[model samples]
Target: MEHTRFARFGMVCTVDHLASTAGLSMLDQGGSAADAAIAANAVLAVTAPHACGLGGDLFALVHEGGGAPQALNASGRSGSGADPGRLRAEGHDRMPFQRDIRSVPVPGCADGWMALHARYGRLPLAELFAPAIRYADEGFPASPLLAPAAAVLPGVDAALAPGDLIRRPGVARTLETLAADGRDGFYLGEFGKGLLALGRDGAAGGSGEGEYTEADLERVNADWVEPLRARAFGHDVWTIPPNSQGYLLLLALAIADRLDLPRDPSDPLWAHLLAEAARAAGHDRPDVLFEGASVDGVLASAAERRATIDPSRRARLRDLTSSGDTTYLCAVDSEGMGVSLIQSNAAGFGSMLFEPATGINLHNRGIGFSLVPGHPAEYGPGRRPPHTLAPALVTRPDGSLRAVLGTMGGDSQPQILLQVVARLLASGESPGQAIGAPRWRVGPGLTGFDAWSEPDEASLDVEQGAGWTEGLQERGHPVRGLPYGGAFGYAHLIDVRPDGVLAGAADPRALISSAAGR
Candidate 1:
């Protein structure tokens, strides 16, 4: 029995129920899906402040008129204070997450969201911001997810107290200004002064060595490019262009293509294939996927090389950190348009700083550094980190967009999405079934020798007396059965069927998710 419900003209799908309500209200007011998305995003920033906020990165994959999608890279860049020379002079080879003002970059999100809204918006900013502004000012109820997020995160109480109006008067005013003047107001205008002032103070400096100035914000611009993907099983698979973790999703698809199996949801072989595909993606991460400007370079490589890969190598994945921070949202309108998007602060409560003046939190993508100096992705001024932040869209043969997705587990997000996609395409699982099914992750497996990985019979068998763990053990993978409800990525994916019927699944792991439409 399918537990999913379908709706028509649904303009909002989100990880937070309040955000979903906010967006749906806009749609009810005759707003486009994009406009509703902006409202929902704003609400999430206010409510799920620890997940992501205006002070972070906002990347979107917007599709229109059956055309190729446009990719917007809203990840902030290094500030003027981000001089590589200073680090070298200080005898530091690579930067860490806790740098002084030198580490904080000009936030690219507020402008990014405004730019997208301007390109495809209808309602004015004031109407769109009402829900978020009201919630922030009046205080909304906290969900279970937020409680833990606050507990794990630093400066939570300062950002917002549980049950308080949690007002971000400054940020709300900033949004109010954006509602009036648009993106330019945030990136190139008086808001620039506020950012500079924040930098001058101790807001961005726990390490006290930052060197940012007004010049960085003035020069920072949101980049627009073509998103890339490969057609498979009669569906178009879209992902962000390189400099982000887009290719990882494609590589997993390419690997799944190699196996060519029946779509059976309960097949243990399916789980094995997912692990193999993820391993293939993991191994290639350091090579082919990371080198590119336009996605064509790597997309072409993936298309040309969709050969069946050996699954044996998956047993030996590395133990480094697997990314576990970020947020994603997906929505499709009654007009047949679908969106696959992502936004993040790099880490929870990113950059660990919230400027009272601007009501913004900075992302700590700086934490994605290598202490090793000679590594390819070493820290530097104006260099974009290899983000695990990726969003996805799947178009079926019948001109249907079955899914739009992204997840919270950074690098592991691709693996999690891969498993769900495989469940839908080859394993014959419903949206809810695919999302609710047990899950497994590889990076976390090797990162903490004893960490649990959900989903795979191998993971379950090793711990829950299942049979697959024997296969995993025989194959030499260091496998640990995760206790139920553990560290899989928080997935938010929506599926729209033919004739405008819509259904979505927000991973139970996250408390903030909903689907509503009339």
Candidate 2:
């Protein structure tokens, strides 16, 4: 039976229940889905700071009244002083990934929220921020996910004893500023000052060398672009263009669209085809998908690569670090408008460089760029790095909204999304069933391998005791079982049905994941 619940007015799905509640409240107050998404994302910055916050980047696919999905790239660019030659002089072989200020970019999330709200919002910014502000000031309970992340914060209580309140007056002040002055409050006012001060101190503390001026902050702006489009499983898929790995999501789906894989979710062949599709995506990722690349060529290449993969053998895949360190959320309104959004601090706790005054943790997104001189994603002044944040939207043949979904899993983002989309489109799985079903990921067989190296062999990691694991092994595919809720992925989905009924689902793997609607 289908476990998904339908809503008439609106729906919100987020990694945290409080965020879902915050968004639903906005919808109840007659705000558009975009407005509700901002509300929920703001709350997430306060509650799930370990995963994402104001100091990170954002990518969104927003569908207005079932119209063509619009794409927003709010990703930050490298600092103007970011020179690859200087980095090599500093004795770094690859882009450094650490708890340092150098990894922090211009921070485009604040501007992202402003742009989204400005386009579709109905309520005042103050009303939208009230919920997050209240939580930061009055202190909500610490989440299970926050416990370990909080323990690492400097000079904070490592222990969250019973009855303890997670009060962050600093975060509250930032929200208050944003509510009043809009984007300027963040990029030019007090928040920007705090960021500059943090950088100065970061250099003084000797973590690493980083230089930033007021100009960098002022120049930060999110771009509105035509979404990269494709057809998969008979539905049109829309995602953000370059600087983000969204094209890879479409590439994987393109492969799936060509094959007649088994529809039975429990069959071993299903997992094999999914993993093979992911493997094909990785091989061509570095060559075809990047800034200014051709969408048609990328899709065509994906089709060619898909034909070469041997179904019974494991394909080479590098071990991308598995950090459950990003938040994805989606909201759809009664008007048939929808917003699918994903935001991140790069890794858990981001660069681990927190600004005490504003309670912000800067993202380590710079690590996404390459130090390799000839690499397409090599670091350069003011260049946007290859981003992993990808949000998605689906539309019917007539261009009506079908669903909005996304997940947080680094390079695993597209892989996880492909698996779920395949189930939804090919097997008739509901949002809940697709999200809650046992999952598998393809990558280097062993953990702790160098993320930058291509592994000589590949392994498929499946949920423990899943029948597909043994079935896959019989077909000569390397298989390993992982504990339930291990490093798989956390997905959130909102589906719009033919009759205009909307339903939402949140992955059960995340303890706080939830969906709320009237």
Best by lDDT: 2
Best-fitting candidate, measured by TM-score?
A: 2
Clash count, predicted structure 1: 18
Cα lDDT listed for each candidate: 0.65, 0.79
CA shift of 233, model 1, Å: 2.8
Evaluated against the true structure, the overall lDDT of model 2 is: 0.79
> Over 4 Å off in model 1, which ranges?
1-3, 88-93, 148-165, 188-191, 198-210, 287-323, 369-376, 397-400, 445-468
Can you tell me which runs of candidate 2 are displaced by over 4 Å?
1-3, 161-163, 201-210, 287-289, 316-323, 444-452
TM of each candidate vs. truth: 0.86, 0.93
Model 1, C-alpha of 342: deviation from truth (Å): 1.2
Task: Give the CA lDDT, 0 to 100, for residue 71 in model 2.
Answer: 92
**lDDT by residue (tens digit), candidate 1, 1-518:** 24354677774667788888888887788777778788888888877766788777878887765656777887776665555555667676545455355555667777677677778777888999999888766667766666545543332463333443345566666777777777767765556666666666645333244345666776654788677776755577888876777777877786577675447635445556666666645554544333244445444444334343344433433432222356777777777666666777766677666665666766676555443455565555666666667888887654456677777776677778887787777666777777767776664433211122231222322223233565554555556775544267677767776656787777766745676565
